[model samples]
Target: SLEVPFPSSREAVIALRSLSPDREPRKGGISKQLTVSGSTLSWSADEARILRVSVNSFLDHLSLVLETMEMFGSPVSQ
Candidate 1:
């Protein structure tokens, strides 16, 4: 089980939704279970390599999304 905390609940929910689709085990015997509560994301997976790959992919997508959000989500209050 892996638990990750996001800066905000909104972001945590977004990450949960984003990573939820891959919950089913793939043909390679890889499975993931994900859930979110408040500002935390909980994930469980089988197979080390598959877990690593899946996590890397998710992180990549997350990085892109965060970058986009920072760029366009809202104007900074000065």
Candidate 2:
């Protein structure tokens, strides 16, 4: 099981929505589950590699979103 905490509930929901549909049909006994509550995301998978890949993909998208938000969502104080 993997649990990730987001900076805000809205960001967590965005991450959840962005990652929820990433599951692909597997031929083996591999299975994956994901859930979101408040500002956290929890994931469970049968295989380590599958989980790693899924997490990597999710992080990639999450990074993009966070960067975008930083770019446009608010003015950064310097």
Cα lDDT of model 2 overall? 0.73
lDDT on C-alpha atoms for all candidate structures: 0.70, 0.73
True lDDT of residue 70, candidate 2: 71
Which one wins on TM-score? 2
Off by over 4 Å in 2: 28-30, 74-78
Tens-digit lDDT track of model 1 for 29-71: 6467677888888777765665676676677766776677677
lDDT of 1 at 53: 68
Candidate 1 deviant stretches above 4 angstroms = 22-30, 74-78
- Residue-level error in angstroms, candidate 1, position 10: 1.8
Write the residue-wise lDDT of candidate 2 on 1-78 in tens digits. 788887777777766777667567778754887778887877888677777766787667767866776777653343
